[model samples]
Target: MLQIDLWKRVLIWALVVAGLVLASPNLFYSRVEQHNDAVKAIEASGATPEREAQAAAWPSWMPSNLVNLGLDLRGGAHLLAEVKVADVYKARMDALWPDLRDVLRPERETVGTVRLQPSQPGELRVRISNPEGMTRALELVRGLAQPVVSLTGAGTSDIEVAGQGSDIVVTLSEAEQRATDERTMQQSLEIIRRRIDEVGTREPTIQRQGTDRILIQVPGVGSAAELKDIIGTTAQLTFQPVVSRTSDAETSAGVGNEVLPSLDEQGTYYVLETAPVVTGEELVDAQPSFDQNGRPAVSFRFNPSGARKFGDYTAANIGNPFAIVLDEEVISAPVIQSHIAGGSGIITGNFTVEEATNLAVLLRAGALPAGMDFLEERTIGPELGQDSIEAGKLATGVAFALVLAFMFFTYGLFGVFANVALILNIGLMFGMLSLIGATLTLPGIAGIVLTVGMAVDANVLIFERIREELKTARGPARAIELGYEKALSAIVDANLTTIITAVILYVMGSGPVRGFAITLGLGIVTSVFTAIWVTRLMIVIWFERRRPRTIEV
Candidate 1:
C-alpha cells in the first residue's frame, strides 16, 4: 500500500484537479451565469460593443453549463391540462366525407342515392334511399380501411363499418383510436415544447400524465396565465378554394363546403371547400412583416411539397378566389391574379405589431392536434423559493460541519484525512451534477446531507479494521493493506445497493423525486471514490514519508 505506481498516482490526482476545476464556477455562480447569458445574446444577435465587452469578462476555456435549478427552487408556474382527444374523432369523420362520397359516386344506381345523416359523435351515418344497397355501400366504405400497425392491433383494420337496414355507420376501431391518441399526444407535446422554447426560458419540465392529461412546469415565468397565453392559440392555418361569397347570414352551403364568417369584413361570409389546398404544417418559416398596404402582416414560406401543390392549384384556377382561413374563420379571399409559384405569400390582417409577432410565433410552432382544457394551475412565488434555498443552505452547512467535527475527534490524525476526502467528495458531486446539467431541488439538498453522513462510513470501517489488525502481530503497512482489502467488499456492496435504489426511484418517480434520485446517486459514486482512493492515497504518502517504527493511526 505504501509503494504506489506512478501512473495510478497521476490519474488519481488528475481526477481531483478536474473535479475542483469544474466545480469552481458554482462558487462564483452569478458572474458565470451573467457571462453565459451575455455570450448567448451575442451569438443570437451580432456581437455589439457592449456584448463583446461582457463576453470578455468570462474566460473562454471555462465551463458555462450550470446545475439547472428546479421549479421548486427557482419558482415558476405549474399547470395540468387535459387534451380533448375525442375532438379528433369528429374531425376525422368530417374529413372522410369527401373520399367516402367519391368512392360511392359511381355506384349511385346500386347504392341508391347515398346521403349523410345526423349521428352520434365519432360515428358517421350514411342513409341509403333503398335498403337493398346497404351491403354494397358498407363494402365500399370498408375498402378504404387500412391495417393497424400496432402489435396488439396488427390484425384489425383502422375503421369499423356496420350496416343496419337502410343506414350504415362508420366509426374508428379500437386500434385506430389508440394510434390516433398517440399521435395527438405527441403533436400536443411537440407544439407545447416549441411554444415554450420560443420564449427563451430555462429548462422546463413538460411531461404526459395519464392517457389524456399533461403536466407542465416552467421555471422563471411570472404566472401560469403567461404560460397559457403563449401556447393557447390553435393557429390552424389553411388555404381552401372559395366555393362562393355571400352577404346573407342564412345562405345555404352545399355539400362538402363550410360557411365561415370573415375575420375583417363586418357582415360578409365565405363558403369554402372542406379540403385544404395547403396547411400550416407545410410552412417552413414565418415572420412579422409589413404588407404592400403598409399594414401589419405575417410573411410565410412553404416547403418544397407545399410549393408544388400550391403552384399547380393556382395555375389551374386563375382569376378564382381562394380563402385563407385561420381557426375556422376566413381571414381573406383574394383572387389569383396570376400563378404563384414561389410558395411565399403575405397575410394582411387587422393586427397590431404585437399581434403580428404573436401570430408569427404561433404559425412557426405549428398547430395543436386538439384543444386543451386546463385542469389545474398554480403560481409559485419567488419568496417561497428564496426561503427554500436559504433553508437548504443552512441545513447543508450544519450537516457538513457536524460530519467534519465527528470524523476529526473519532480517528485523531487519520480522521483529518477522512475529512479532507469528505470535502473533495462533495466537490466532485457538484462537479458531476454541473457537468450533466441536472436540476437541483429541495429534496436534493437532503440527499447531499445524507451523502455527507454516509461518506465517512468506509473510512471508519477501514480505520477500525486497521486498529484491530494492530492489536494482532502486524506491521503498519500490512495492517493498512488488510484493512483496505477487507473493507473493499462492504464499500462496494453498500454503494451499489444505494445506487440501485436511486435508479429505481428515478425510473418510477417524476419532478422533485427525480431531482433527489440524481443527487443521491451521484453522491454515492463520488463518496465511494473519495473514501477508497483519496483517503488511501493520503495514508500511503504519509507512511512512506515518516517511515516510523511505531505509528498511531
Candidate 2:
C-alpha cells in the first residue's frame, strides 16, 4: 500500500541524478564559464592554441551551462537613455521632400515650379508658383500617404496633408507618430542588444523603460563610457553624391543638399545630396579589413536591393565624387573612376585598427533610429560584485544550516530524510536555472534562501500526521501510508498558491524582480517534488528493510 511502482522509482531517481549533474557545473562556475567562452570563441573564429587550452579546462562530456549572474551580482555598466524621438520626425520630413518633388514635378504644367520652404522640425512645407493649383498639389502629395501598418492605427494614413495659403504642408499623423515611436524603441533595444552581444558580454539587459527611454545594463563591461561607446554610436553610414567640396564650413548646401565636416581632414567639408544612394541599413555584412594601401578600413557588402541601387548609382555617376557619410560627418569623398557592378566596397578613413573593428561592429549592429541622451550612467566595479556575492553566500549558507539543524533536531530520522530532499531540491532548482539560462541576482538568492525553510513544510505535515496516526494505534506501515495520504492535498494546495504568486510577480516585474520570481517559482516546484516523492521514497525504503513494528517519526 505504501509502495511506488518500479518504473516510477527509476524515473524519480533518474531525474534527481540528472538535475544534480546539471547543477554540478555551478560548483566550478569560473572554470566552466571560461570553457564556455573559449568554446564560443572557437566556434566563431577558428580555434587557437590559447582558446583550445581554455576549452579543455572543463570536460567535454560534462554539463557546461551555469546560472547567469545578473548585473548587480556581476557588476558592470548601467545607463538610462532618453531617445530623441523628435529627430526621426525631422528626418521623415526631410525624406518626404524628395518624394513630394518627384510627384509634383510630373504635373509641373499644372502646378508650376515647386520650391521647398523650411518650416518647423516635423513639418514639410512646399510652395508652388501657381497658388490656384494648391488643391491639385495637395492631392498629388497626399497620394504618397500609405496606410499605417499597426493594429491601433487601422485605416489611418501615415501623413496628414493640409493647405496653408500657397503652401502644401505635410506632417505625420498622430497614429503614425505612435507607431514610429514604438518601432524606434523596439529597434533601439534590438540594436543595443546586438552591439553588446557582439562584444561577448554575458546577459546584458537592454530594454525600453518609458515612452522614449531605454535602460541598458551590461555585465563585465569595463565602464559606463565603454558600454556607451559600444551601443551609443549612431553609425549611420550613407553614400551620397557630392555636390561640392569646400574648406569653409559656412558654405550653403542649397535645397536637397547637406554640408558635413570631414572626419579625416579638419576644416574641410563636403556638400552632399540629402538622400543617400545606400544606407547602413542596407548593408548585409561589414568586417574590419585593410584598404589597397594596407591601412585599417571596413569592408562592407550590401543586400540585393542595396546592391542594385549602389550599382546603378555608381554606373550613372562615374567620374563624380561620392561622399561616404557617417553620423553627419564625411569619412571620405572619392571620385568614381569606373562602374562598380558589385555591391562590395571598402571604407578607408583615418582609423586605427581598433576604430576599424569598432566601426565594423557598429555597422553590423545597424544604426540607432535616433540619438540618445544619457540621463543616468553608473559603473559598478567587480569588487562591489564580489562583496555582494560573498554576502549572498553567507546568507544562503546560514539559512541552509539553520533549516537543516531544525529539521534534524525536531523530526529525528524522518527529519534527516527531509534534509536530504531539501539539499536535492536546491540542486534541482539550480539545474533548472542553468538549463534555461536564467540570470541570478541578489534578490534571487534571497528567494532561494526563503525556499530552504519552505521545503520541509510538506515533510512536517506528513510527520505530524504520522504522530497523530501512531497515537490511534495504527501499525507503522499503515501510519506512514495514512500520513502521506492526508498530507498530499495540503502540500499541493500550499505550494500551488505560492507558485501562482511567483508567476504573477514574474509577469508584473522587470530585471531583478523577475530574477527573484524565477528562482522562487522554480524552488517551489522542486521543493514540492522532493517533499512528496524523494523523502517519502527514502522513508519507505528504510521501513521496508528494517521492518520496524513501531517507528519514531
Candidate 3:
C-alpha cells in the first residue's frame, strides 16, 4: 500500500506542479490585470509606446486569468428590474390594426366600416357600423390568428377573437401572452447583457428573476444611478413619417397620428405617423461619427430588408420630412433630400460627443421590447468591499494556523504532512477557480473557511484508524496500510454527500449563494484529491526512505 506505481507517482506530481503553476499568478493579481487590460486596449486601438511598455510589463507566456471578484467583493451596483410585459400586449394589438384593416377593407360593404374603439388593456376593440355583419367580421378576424407554439399551450391560438353586440374584442390568448412574456424576458436579458458587455465591465451578473423580473449586478460601476444611466433607457428609436411640424403643444394630430415634443428644441412639436417606417430592430450597426457640419452625430446602417423598404420610401417621398424619434421624443424632423439607397443615414441633433457615443452604443445593442420598472437598486462601496476582503483573509489565516497547530500537537510529523497537503488543496481549489474564471463573493470566502475544517477530516480519520490498529498489536506498516484502506469508504461517503448538497445549491440558488456553491464544490474535489493522493504520496515517500522500526502516527 505504501509503494505507488511509477505512472501514478508521475501523474500525482504533475497535477501538483500544474496546480502551483496556475495558482501563482494570483499572487500578483493587480499587475497581471493591468497588463492584460493594457494589452486589450492596444489590440482595440493602436499600440502606442506607452501601451506597448505597459503590455511588456507582464511576460506573454505567463497566465493572466485571475479569480474574478463578485459584485459584493468588488463593490458595484445591484438592480432588480421588472419588465412591463403588458406593454407588449398593447403594441401587439396596435401592430395588428394595420393588417386587420388591410384584410377587412375590401369586405367593408358586407361587414360594415370597422372603426377602432377604446377597450381594455391588451384588447383591440372594433365597432361595426352594421350590427348584422358581426359574425362575418368576427370570422375574418379569427382567420388572422396564428397557432401558438408553446409547449404548455400547443393546441391554442395566438389570439382570442370574440364579438359582443356590435363590436369585436380581440385579445391575446393565454398561450400567446405566455410566449410573448418569455420572448420579452429573453430579449430584455440579452439586451441588458449586451449593454453591460459593451462597457467591458468584469463579471457582471445579468440573470432573469421569476417570470417578469431581471437581477443585474455589475462590479466596478460607481452607483445604481450610474448603472441605470448606462442601460436604463429603452432607446426605442423609430423613423416615422412627419404629418406636420408646429410650436403648439396642444395641437392634436387626430386619429392614427400623434404629436411628440422635440428633445433638443423647446416648444417644438412634431405630428408623426403612429406606426414607424423603420425601427431600431432593423439596425445592423451604429457608430458615433461627425455630421457634414462637424457636429457629433450617430451613423447607422440597416439590414437588407429594412434598407429596401427605407430606400423605396425615400425614393417615393424625397421632398417630404420624416421624424427621428427616440423613446417617444422627436429628435429631428428632416426632409428626405435624396433617395437613400444604401440604407445608411446619420442622426444629427444637439448632442455632445459622449451623448453621441452612448446613443450609438444603445442603437447597436438593439431596443428593449418594453420598459423596465426598477424595483430595487443599491450600490456597494469599494471601502466596504476591501474591509470584507481583509476580514476574510484574517479569518482564513487564523483558521489555517489553528488547524495546523492542533494537527501537529495530536499527530506530530504526520500532522505536518497533512497540513502541507491541506495548503496544497486550497491552492488547487483556487487554481481551478482561476482557470474557470469563477467569481469569488463574500459567501464564497465563507465556503473556503468551511472547507479548511472539512479538508482535514480524511487525514484525521486515517490517523485515528492507524492509532487503533497500533493499539491492537499490528506492525507499523501494516497498521498504516489497513488504516488508509478501511478509512477509504468512510471518506468517500462523507465527501460525496457534501458534494451532492453543493451541486443542489449551485443548481437551485442564485448570485452569491451560487458563488458559495461553486467554491464549496470545487473545494470538495480538491480536498479529496489532496487527502487520498497527495497525503498518501507524502507518507509513502517518508516510509520508503526511513524504513523505521517504529513510528509515532
TM per candidate comes to: 0.90, 0.96, 0.92
Higher-scoring candidate on lDDT, 1 or 3 = 3
Tell me, what's the RMSD of every candidate? 2.9, 1.8, 2.6
> lDDT of candidate 2?
0.92
Q: Which residue pairs collide in model 1, if any?
A: none
lDDT of each: 0.89, 0.92, 0.90
TM-score leaderboard ranking: 2, 3, 1
lDDT of each residue in 33-152, candidate 1, tens digit only? 778878887765468888777777779998777787778888999999999999988878877876888898899889888888777878888888878888888889999998987777
Instruction: State the lDDT of candidate 3 residue by residue for 287-313, as single tens digits.
Output: 999999999999999999899989999
Best prediction by TM-score: 2
* Stretches > 4 Å off in candidate 2: 292-296, 350-353
Model 1: CA > 4 A from native: 45-54, 112-119, 127-132, 163-168, 245-269, 284-308, 342-361
By lDDT rank, best first, the candidates go: 2, 3, 1
